[model samples]
Target: MSQLMSIDTFLDSEEVLVDVRTPSEFLKAHIPKALNIPLLTDQERAEVGTLYRHKGKEKAVLKGLDLVGPKMSDIVRSFLEVAPKRTVRLYCWRGGQRSQSVAWLLEQAGFKAKILKDGYKSFRRWVLNHFEREYQFRVLGGYTGVGKSDLLQILENKGAQVLDLEKEAHHRGSAFGGIGLPKQPSTQHYENKLAMRLRAFDMRLPIWLEDESRLVGKCAVPEFLFQQISRAQLFVVCRTIEERIVRLCQLYGVEQKQSLIDACMRIKKRLGLEHTKKAISLIEAGLLDEATLIILKYYDKKYQYSIDKRVVSLYLNGSEMSDVQLAERLLNR
Candidate 1:
C-alpha cells in the first residue's frame, strides 16, 4: 500500500526521494537530493497536456496510459537500481495521477512508497514560507578582497553558524565572480538551495552571512530574506590598500588572463574607458596585483557608498589580525 505524507514528514523521512515529473519540469526546480525518474519525456508531457486541453480528461488519460505502458518496467527498474531500501518517497508536480500511478506500480513490486502531499508544489510553498520567518543573522560587510569569505569559513570551523551565500550562489559577488566557477543554478533552484541551508541552522543562534546585493551574479536572494539581511546589523571588516591588492591577486591570479580581461570589460562603463583599458593591459602583462589595485579603486568607492547606508554594528581592522583571530573576536563579541 502507498501512503501520502505532509511536506514536513515527507522531508524528514529517511526514504530516498524520486521525482516523477517530466524532465523539463524536474530541470526547472526540484527538492534537493531528489532523484529524477521522469514519468514522461518533455514532448510526451506536452502531447498529454494538449490532449487534455483539446479532447478532454478521458482521452488524455488513455493517451497517458498508452505512453506509459511500455515504460513501466523501465521506471520500476530505474527506481530499483537507486533505491537503498525497499521504502521510497515519490512526488510529482501537484500530487497528481503521475505520482499515484508510480507509487501503485512500486507497491505491486513489493516496495513501500510514500507520496508528498500536494507534491513539489507543496515543497515550494514550504520553501517560500521559510524565508518569511525571522532568523538571527550576522551580516559580514567589507570592500572587495577583505577576506570576508575566508573569515566566514574560519568562523564555521570554530562552530559558529555560517551561511556562505556566495558559495550557495556559486559566485563571489563581483563582476569577476563567474570567471572560473561552475554554471549557476536558476534563481528558483538557488532559492531552494538557500532555504535548505537556512533550515539547518538554529533560529536562535546567529547565522553569519556575507553582505550581498539583491542579485548575486544571476541569482536573486529571495525578497523576504534579502529584507532581513538588509535590516540586520553589519560587522564591517577593513584592510589597507596594499593588503587588499595582494589578497585579490591571490584569489584571481590563477584564472585565465583573457577571462580576467573579459570580466573587467563587463563593467567598462562604471570602471571608465581609461581605467578599463589600463586594467586589461595590466592583466595581459601578468601584473595581477597592479591590475587588482586599479579594479579596487572603483569597487572601494561603490562599497563605501553601500556601507554608509547600512547600520554597522562594528568594524574590525582585517589587516591587523589573522582569520582565526578575527573569527574568535566575532564569536566572543
Candidate 2:
C-alpha cells in the first residue's frame, strides 16, 4: 500500500479526489476541484456528533460503524461509478478515521487508493495560505449598476486579457444578482473554468478581474485567486446614481420589478421598514427615479461600506470617463 500523501502532493498528481464530507458541508464550501462522495449522510453525521458530545466516543464510534456497515457495498459501488479508472485519492474532514476506513476498503478490493495526509482540513489551510500571500492583479471596482460586465465584454472583444469571475461562477454577485442568471456552477466546475481562463492569459501582463467575495453564489474562488485579488491594485468605476439605476434596470430587465421589491423587503430590517415601505411605494407608483434614489442611498452606501472594508489602493470613479476611454485605460493599465 502506498503511504498517505499530503494535499499538496495529491494536488500535483493525476488523480481524482474523493471527498467524504457531508453534502451540506460540501455545498457550503469545499476545496477547489474536489468531487464529493460522502461516507455519511448529513443527519447521520449530526447524530454521530451529538452522540460523541452527549454520550461518549465509544458509543459514537459504535453507532457510526452500525450505520456505515450496512451501506458499505452501496457506498463502494457509488464511489466506483464516479471515480476515474486511473489513480484515486480519498479524503474526509481530517485524514483520521473515515478516510482511512475508505482507503483501506479500496485497497482490499484490489484498487489503489491513496489517503490524503491531513484530509480536507489541510487542503483548506493550503488554500488560505496561498490566498494570504501576495500576487499581482488588476481589480475592476465600480459603483452599483455601472455595467462592469459590459465593460468586461468590451475588453474581451478588444482582445484584452480578462477574468470574468461572475461569469465563471454564473452569478452577478449581488442580492438580486441571481435573477435571470443561469444556475451557478459547482465549486469544482468554477475552479476548472477559472484555471482554463488563467492559463489563457499572458503571464507577462497582469490579470484583470472584478472585486468579489470568496464565495460567489454556490461556488468558491480558489485560494490562490482569492489571495491575488485581495492584494491586487484596484481601479474604481464611478457613475451617477441615475446612470447606475438605468444601467441596472437594463441588466436586470424591467420584468424584475417584483424581484426588486422582494429584495428590498428582505433588507427591510437593515434599511428600516419605513424606508423599505417608501422604496416599495415608489416602485409601485412607477416612479423608478424615486425608487432608485431611495435604493441608491441605501444600497450604494452598503456597497461603499464593503469597499471601505476591503481597502484596495487604486481608485477611479467611472463617472468621469467615457466608456471607450475607460476600456482603453483598463486595458493599457
TM-scores for candidates 1 onward, in order: 0.98, 0.70
Residues 39-128 of candidate 1 have per-residue lDDT tens digits of 899999999999999999999999999999998999889998999477899999999899999999888888999999999999999999
Report the number of clashing residue pairs per model.
0, 4
- Model 2 spans with C-alpha error above 4 angstroms: 46-65, 84-86, 153-205, 211-232, 238-243, 254-256, 266-278, 285-290, 297-325
Query: Pick by TM-score: which candidate is best?
Result: 1
Q: How far is 314's C-alpha from truth in model 1 (Å)?
A: 1.1
Regions of model 1 farther than 4 Å from truth: none
Q: Write the per-residue lDDT of candidate 2 for residues 1-333, one digit (tens) a residue.
A: 746987667777767777888898787666566788888999999999999999999999999999999988887787777774735788888888888877776776566888888877786666545434344578888776887788878887888788899998888876666777788877765665666456556777766788887887768888777777876787788787778888766665565678778878877888888889998898778776677677677767877886886766655567788787788887766
Q: Find the 10 residues in a row with the least total lDDT in model 1.
A: 78-87
lDDT of the structure predicted as candidate 1: 0.92
Error of 1 at 13 (Å): 0.7
Deviation in angstroms for 270 in model 2? Answer: 7.7
